[model samples]
Target: MLNAIVIGGGLAGSQAAIYLADNNVKVKLYEMRPNKTTGAHTSSDFAEFVCSNSLGAQSVTSASGLLKEEARLLGSKLIEEAYNNRVPSGNSLSIDRWGFSKKITQIIENHPNIEIIREEITQLPKTPTIVATGPLTSDSLCSEIKKLTGEDNFHFFDAVAPIVKKETINFEKAFYASRWDKGNADFINCPLNKDEYENFYNILTTAEKIPLKSFEAKYFEGCMPIEVIASRGFDTLRFGPMKPVGLFDKRTREEHHKNYQFYAVVQLRQDDKQADLYNLVGFQTNLKWGEQKKLINSIPALENAQIVRYGVMHANTFINSPKILNKTLQTKFNPNLFFAGQITGVEGYSESIATGLFAGINMLRHLRGEKLLELEAKCMLGALLEYITFANHKAFQPINSNWGIVEKPQEVEKLKKKSKEEKGALLSNIALEYIKEIRNGYFC
Candidate 1:
């Protein structure tokens, strides 16, 4: 029997292990926590949710949601477990962090073909292995990865958002609505008039920011700190992430007010199924907790805001995927070895799980002496794999799954009258059908 070793028991590693074991492959899963630790994780459990419990949008029309559905159809262990433990949070799939991790750990431990090993792995195994060490990978393994992939191939630093408990929010001043009637009005909009926006902007610009450690200075472009966005220019944020276009306040019903479209708007997205918490949309920051509360509360709607968690920035690590791996997620240098999750440069929980499933499926193919499965680019999961393996090597950065990366149908593009969501739904349906075909073959 072929044996597979999966390093790091985070979301990616756990998923990889489960899929491999389910296929009748013997697997060893290694986790370095409780023995050693990262700056982000607090528990020793496998697949720990370090930041937020919410996985992302739950609508099939949204890219994140569509990815989740794709994962579900593929019999993704992580998504299945998450769904069963899901809490109510509007249209997003959120889980209890502690409960989620505990459940995953239990399942992996109970699997007959899988063995859990607790120790810090300083070196890679020469035998077949999958590296899904995620962003907060330990220092020693990172160095080993650097030697194998080359110095310029790895990265470190992640901009994270603060999670707030639902009970803490002052709902009297907040209202829920998706922008322009999109996605079931799933987001909570915190409206700001001209004066309120200016006041909040001023505080944000002047508030104290958490300084980067001497060793970690450069920030990833994709996950820039909110303070960095503010420093670019006063209106920089307004034009960038905090832009208030496409949203109309039903309470105000003043769509064309011209001047007060919103000096700015801070959106809080539902973080769990239970609506017990909301994450500040596009508000990832490195501000001190006190400063975050002081500055964030300056907004009119958040004057009485209560913070359950504060935004933090941490060092994230990844490999130069385009130069190292094939679409099957196996390393070019070693066919027996595979890579998955953030370490492979794909971002977000769903993206990580997709890579894990791909690695798992391909690993099974290798063991069974069958041809590897290479999905079509039209599929979202397939497109993500293609992107990581084929994006420009020098400019390749970690990417979250987005519609912009998916291969668009020519028929959809030609229709100018269709809304973006309309086109997205059509493409999503096609992708799901393709995934179903893949699943049918595997399940039978």
Candidate 2:
């Protein structure tokens, strides 16, 4: 049997270890969790979701959905585990955060071929290794990584939204509905009248925020602090996350809503399997804890909202993948060393799991002395790998899976003839076909 080392028990590392162990590899997985803390995490479980529980949409036409589908075709362990612990979120893949991590922790701990190490690995290993330490990497291991790459990792700040007790929300001001009636009423919508929106905006923008001097880093655009987003403009929130389009608050009749339905709306997504907790959608903030509680209380439907967890901001570090990694996710200097997840400059939960899945696959091939497999350029996983490993290293920022990164059909006339959804369907089919073909060859 072959031996492999997996560092970090977060999403990526856990995925890599599970894939390897299932394939008959003797693996040692290292996690520095309860013993060492990353300020963002609140649990000791593997694959813990520290930020939002949602993993984007599940439709194959969507970018993240397609990436997840591709990983599923490739037999991604964490992806399956995610679905097993999923919650109701319309078309999106939201999970019971606690259940998802707990299941993965149990599986990893009990695996026969995998040995769990409850310690931190401060330096890179010379053996077959996959470093999936993720974004919140410890300072000591980061220094060791820097020594190998000779480049400082780019740092960004990620903000998490606050979770509120569901029963505390005032039903009179809030209603259950999904946007455009796309599915059952999976989202808790808090509609705001013009005056109420104005008041909420004023309070949100003026709320005291924690000092940024501690991190001294710029916020990732995808997870910007709500207050920072508010600073952009008064109407930015309305146009962005708080947009009131495609929603009908049944309580307001057409006669009463003759002019407009609502000025803005806030959405809270279900967080746990029991449906007792919901996180403020797109309300990631760095406000002081007291200010966060006050802000939540100010929402019309949340006048007495009980906060289960306050929003927080944390430092994230990622390597410059274009400079240091090959398309196979292997380090340029060491074939035995590969980096996965956010550390490889790919963003989002599905993207992280996809990278780790492929890294584990290539590691198996390396052990067999076979050429590392490069996913087809037309596929979702392939496009992400191509973008990160070949993009301009100096200006590279973390990226999520999007159609723009994937290879597009060359026939201009065909594309012009199709609607947006039609185009997405065509692209998805192409990507899936490629991934399915790999399935037979790699796993059979």
Candidate 3:
């Protein structure tokens, strides 16, 4: 019987361990929590979502959605669990955070072929291993990784948005609507008129922020703090996160103002099955506690909003993947070792699951003395791996799943199409065919 060591119990490690265990391999899954917790996590549960509850858009025409569909085709264990515990967020796949983590912890703890080890691993094991420690990797292990991959691994800070109680939001000013009314009216919107928006922007830009510690460098472009974004200009927030296009205020419409539109809107996405908690959409911040409360209260309907959790920032680290890893996620010089998740430079929850699935499948092939497998670059998953493992080494950075990484087939490229949704649909169809071929030619 083949046995493997899996390090860290975040999304990627848990998914990899489950995949290997289901395939009849024994897995020792190490989670350094409860005894040694990352500052962001509140539980010892595997696959805890420390950031926003969203898994991004869930339509095939969207890049994140396409990546998720590909993961589903590959039988990603976490994606199944996420869907099982989903909370409404229009077309995006958001889950009941606590329920989702509980289910994943239960599954990992109960697996027959898996052993849950509750201890921090200070050094990488010599046995066949998968390192999915994620961005908040501990200092000692990070040092060890640096020794192996050189001292040039990159670091940046990521912030989490605040969560508020649903009851505190005033319904008189807030209404439910999704962008372009494309899906169910699942998102709660707080409308701000031109004057209200201008006042909010002034206070936001002038609000005091928490200074980063000496170790934390620049913020990741994807998760820049709301205040940092506000500092760009007077109209930056209006055009960026607070853009109110493609949405109508139900209250205003009911009040006989058919053509009325707000200057800006703040969105709140449901974060739990009970609908009692909602996270501020695109409101990640590192402001001081007092400043956060003042800024939040300044919003039209959120004057008395009860904050369940405050926004925070933490250092994110990633390996220099192009120089250290192969497309199969194996260390180029040490074939028995592998990496996954944000630690290997793939961002977003769904992207982490994809890398975990690939690492698990490839590890199994390695054990059986078979040729290590890699997906064709025509697919999103393959393209993401190809970029991380083969992109220019000197300019490496963490990346989320996007269609830009995917290499387009000639037919789509020849048509001179600029629509992302159109290109995504064409790529989605081709990727599905590749999935069918992979199933028939390999796993079958």
Please tell me which predicted candidate would have the highest lDDT against the true structure: 2
lDDT of each: 0.81, 0.90, 0.89
Q: Residue-wise lDDT of candidate 3 within 1-444, one digit each (tens)?
A: 999999989999999999999999999999889999787898988999999999998997888888888888888989998999999998899999999999998998889999999999998999999999999999889999888777566889899999999999998889899988888999999888889998898888888888887874767677888888888888888888898887897545767566666789999999999999999999999888888898899998999999999998888888989988899999998988999999998889999999999999999999888899888888888888998988566788888888888888898897575676777788889987897788677787
| TM-score for each candidate, following the candidate numbering | 0.88, 0.97, 0.97
Estimate, for each residue in 134-246, the C-alpha lDDT of model 1 and write its tens digit. 98888898888878877465555667787666665666667777666655776777777777777777888888877776674656665677888888988888876678876
Total clashes in model 1, counting residue pairs 3 or more apart in sequence or in different chains: 14
Residue 419 displacement (Å), model 2: 2.2
**Could you give the C-alpha RMSD of every candidate to the true structure, in order shown?**
3.0, 1.4, 1.5
Better of 1 and 3 by TM-score: 3
What C-alpha lDDT, on a 0 to 100 scale, does residue 354 get in candidate 2? 94
For model 3, give the RMSD to the true fold: 1.5
lDDT of 2 at 192: 87
Query: Considering TM-score, which of the candidate structures 1 and 2 is the better prediction for this target?
Result: 2
The TM-score obtained by model 1 is 0.88
Q: Which ten residues in a row have the lowest lDDT in candidate 3?
A: 250-259
